[model samples]
Target chain A: MLNPGSLTVIGLGPGSPAQRTPEVEAALAEATDLVGYAPYVARVPHRPGLYRHASDNRVELDRARHALQLAEAGARVAVVSGGDAGVFAMASAVFEALEAGDPAWRALDIRVLPGISAMFAAAARIGAPLGHDFCAISLSDNLKPWEVIQHRLLAAALGGFVMALYNPLSRARPWQLGAAFTLLRQHLPGTVPVIFATAVTRPDERITVTTLAEADPALADMRTLVMVGTAATRLLPRPGGAAPWVYSPRSVPAS
Target chain B: MLNPGSLTVIGLGPGSPAQRTPEVEAALAEATDLVGYAPYVARVPHRPGLYRHASDNRVELDRARHALQLAEAGARVAVVSGGDAGVFAMASAVFEALEAGDPAWRALDIRVLPGISAMFAAAARIGAPLGHDFCAISLSDNLKPWEVIQHRLLAAALGGFVMALYNPLSRARPWQLGAAFTLLRQHLPGTVPVIFATAVTRPDERITVTTLAEADPALADMRTLVMVGTAATRLLPRPGGAAPWVYSPRSVPAS
Candidate 1:
């Protein structure tokens, strides 16, 4: 049912139009107000009845509140995020806004539409390094302490988890990813595969597969997703010497 | 370009047709052979040229080899998997086969299509409990040792990761999920939210949101995906006493 005043949180799916689900497309078509980060909002096509409410990054909560306000005022709203909105995106912020906002807002209809996350999209472009048990950690220390990130990295490395690291490096936090690599090197074998996927699914996409020993911090930027494979991961040699296929096997022999 | 003898690994996206991406849909339309677990293969629409090759569960390697051989014989093959194929699904098995099989298989065109994984779909059904740092661990001990699963469970719990546990409980591994709960209970608060989502996005879908103290192992089965929220997760009170929203906040206060 199309509620007159409702908020639908939808993912844009890593900058590719083909990756967007039909449900998300329907939500966008129905939306009177589109609210999201500026880059993500710019991805949507301009329509006559739709109002684009684009804001800068790091203002997720403010964006969530704006969507809620629009919905409360009887506007059909779609809150957008690149990749899956639930994964380190605007869905959580929307819920946080609903939690702290007027109690009447709780009665408003809200839906979250899932999409292909950046980690999965990147993993797919370069075979599947996340084809086994994995963990996703955001290296940006904007919220959590650096100590927590360090501890989790050590835990993931020691546990033999294939890891997808989001926001690996930014101008402000240049040293965190290097420190994380150092911690992994201490526990994981140097032969383990590490994939650096930058701007995945976009025209400027770059996917590189390297070993843990050869992994450089500079290979990753804010737009990159770094996938570190477990010891069991394999690098298949391509015929004619193309980029090798990187993937983790499904089975692990009994310990 | 659509290669005549190509292999495309596609995700069915948690059982909903609307959840399937157009890229995957196009791959299905172009495939001459469809291979996967019985239930997932059964989801594909019937077509005159498509040959459905459905096999029982746990025969992933055999299925992969079959698909490869068919593709090698100049058939456009689509390997289908429920949810995202990369996440503990056929994508890994296919890669393993390619690495161990004839080197000629390496020259074949291969692609993996990402979809909405069970964890993401389950998270959206309620609210985004995975809106922060998270780990996905497969609970079935069919491959890895039980001890490894236990250690990772504890690591994820202690590390304050919102966790999505796949293959939580099967008939053969009925006790594994319970053991995981016991391990988590030691490190996490009893008030943390635990969501058991069974057959997500399917007609018979069941979603239960409970507290760590009250979560019952019997409530989950092989088809269930269990999500445990972090200490930072919130449960919003619904207006008129409906189901409360469950979500983890995007930011964490410094420890």
Candidate 2:
């Protein structure tokens, strides 16, 4: 008899209940096992039937394999990711495991649910720095090399593409973000706006919109989503001394 | 007397109610007037005391101005977009209008509520095409020139970005997507996967996953979100002939 086991990879959407979709909420409610990075898994409240398995951030593949194992054992598992799981998140790791694992796992029901990405969440908090063409690069050299990051940063800068930098800085690799900024400045003007949004949509949310010239790398941490504006990006001054609205206009100037 | 009016730009995620966030649902329930392009505005169910103002897609700035004007007159206005408003949607246009319009509009209660983007929705429908480094580019030449789109596309392709392309083609610009595929072929391997997800997450949704060599531009329309994979992208076959799982692994091999 085939076990009625299934795995759902769901995104919680940047630490806010409001940001999560009705689909993910339903998945979370029906799940027998919850697995994810420690902080993200802890975000989901404990219920008697839901067994939570929280792991450290570095062990994404191991966590994914464990979740798959639980599902294979006839448990309805929900592997959670903070933002959209598809974007440099658990969805990738799950698929990687599914490929390298047992062929029977392929027959198991699996689905990926999208969520509000931290980059888009941060962009929403600011006026829409990603209003135009933008690229999202992970600044963590853990996965790729520092050289790849530098090359992509320079290419994005030269192409006049606005950028969203994820995993901008952490204890393991602190200098990568600063070095990226330095390389970007070589191609982009100093006046370009760089926004650092930490713990976006959470209570400790701090949004600092500064220019490339004065931007401090120390302002960002692992929770931060950094956005670099294109030359066409405008910072509209708000009355009553509120935070200025920054947006990239839909139209680019005729070349 | 202060007007209790407010303006909220909300995204109706990819034509699916399940994909929409709870925050957007609350905003919709509270809104007195809904303003957006005709198709998106039509998505909202009509109720007593709620008014809908739908217009053509070409007049985003004008529609934004109208929404602002409604909010100025004490209307609880919801300007809706199909995907995340911050991503090539009404938010940028609204901010553009806010910057150019009267100063008092800034003082008005204007906020951007994030929603699930079409790109992510499409990515989830497949496996995780955007699992690694990614960029989102709009191929519509209505706002920007074709040359700029070409430049950004080339840059993203060269930088090893798994790209989520919006507005891949329409009647006005038929050849842009084909030319893009050609440009990509020059830099990327012909075996790279290109996915066209049309009307993603909706009743009429259609997905076509093919390689760069076999990709047909005719498969896409304005309602489609196209994904072009990088060299690192993989397509894992499944048991019993299900659609192949496509994803980019989190780690890149050392250069």
Candidate 3:
């Protein structure tokens, strides 16, 4: 039997109202409760019937639990995340809570609606830097040990995979991106392009492309998404003195 | 000086009309020419002034060249690709053409619009199997050597990445998925979940969850997007015996 309650985990896309999928918009419109980080919850305009449960950024688990509890109470809850919810976002958190929480939440008509990921938004701003095989790694050591990050970074480099590094650097995690760069340098060439795409599609978006040797972690903040190209990635000058386009060719790069 | 001609490459998202973003829809509606594979081109309804150039799927380069040439001739051309265009799609092919074609082509305006990827759509259908660090690898040997695929697959596995495998299998290349499974078995535990999500969100969509050891290559086709879970991926039974929810937690996995 279906529960009267329903919970939807929706990705708002990378900060643009235009980037949000139609399905996600419909879900948000129909939701009785909006639950997420304060910034993400604020993205959706306030409506009289919709209750917004904006919480601290660090409390994903608690936020997830609250959303589930509301859903069980017969509220149509929408838990929002920026970018695609399936990729390192609220979908995972909601699933984690569902697995460990009351068994009754399972039948609560849970669905995850996807949105354009920040990684893809950043990649699109350049040419297709992720045209070939690629991996995405998080630089924050808050959840995993620093050793694990290093191991994955080195392995991704050795695999010749183009990489999109999320949470590259922050006030508390200032050193991880630099350390990641040093480890990657051992495996990749100096000429490989490293792109720091900040606040993609938003008014303050800035995209900087430099070689691996010249890459400085100082350019990145918590809002930035860093992309390290494979050896095959190329940079071409624009005909009108615009920023050069960067992309990895579709064919195989030497491994 | 900016050329009057413009070219835009757009992602159509996973087969669902509602999944497409408004920006992509606007691009498609304003397009003078739509260039892409036949199926993707057919997705858009016929309009009075829109000319469609549906071509063979294998001729990505020639189609890309045709689109660029049209754009140079002052046509507002849109090149469409199913799923995210930057992910092993038309965006890279267009760049490759631009690099090798007439230098004057560089003057043409080009933009890539992000779309929801089939990988993300597939991940949402199941729970968030890609919640943690992950990689996307195409299984087709058409663009790269089987050896290179093996090397990278091993690297991603060693890095403990949940993998989203695109173009997983086809009659043209029958053994790659099986070979990949055999190679991955050397490093990952058999208990790791393997999700085969086919033609996601389409009328004929199918999703099967199996363990690494029990995964069958026959379950996939060219339309399939396969996901392999990491050690941290978990599965939980529904209260009403619906399909179990599967996800990788946000916290660190034992690496």
Q: Of the candidates shown, which would achieve the greatest lDDT relative to the real structure?
A: 3
CAPRI category for model 3? medium
- For each candidate in turn, the TM-score is 0.97, 0.99, 0.98
Question: Which lDDT values do the candidates have, in the order given?
Answer: 0.90, 0.91, 0.92
| TM-score for the A-chain in each candidate structure | 0.96, 0.98, 0.97
Tens digit per residue, CA lDDT, model 1, B1-255: 433699999988999888899999999998999999999999998989889999998888999999999998899999999999899998989999998898888889999999889999999989888988899999988888888888889888877789999999888788988888888989999999999999988899998889998889999988899999988899886666555779998787874
* A188 Cα displacement, candidate 2 (Å): 0.7
User: Cα deviation of A11 in candidate 1 (Å)?
Assistant: 1.0
Better model by lDDT: candidate 1 vs candidate 2: 2
DockQ of 3: 0.79
Q: In terms of TM-score, which candidate is stronger, 1 or 3?
A: 3
Q: Candidate 1, after superposition: displacement of residue B69 in Å?
A: 0.9
Where does model 1 exceed 4 Å of error? A1-3, B1-3, B240-242
lDDT tens readout by residue for model 2, A62-176: 9999999999999999999989999879999999999999878888889999999998899888888999999889998888888888888888888788999999999988798
Report fnat, model 2.
Answer: 0.87
Best by TM-score: 2
lDDT string for model 3 (B1-255, tens) is: 556888999999999988999999999989999999999999889999999999986899999999999999999999999999999899999999999999989888899999999999999988898899999999888889889899999999999899999888788889999999999999999999999999899999999999999999999988999999998899977665566778988788456
Across A107-180, the per-residue lDDT of candidate 3 in tens digits comes to 78899999999999999999999999999998888888899999899889999899999999888788999999
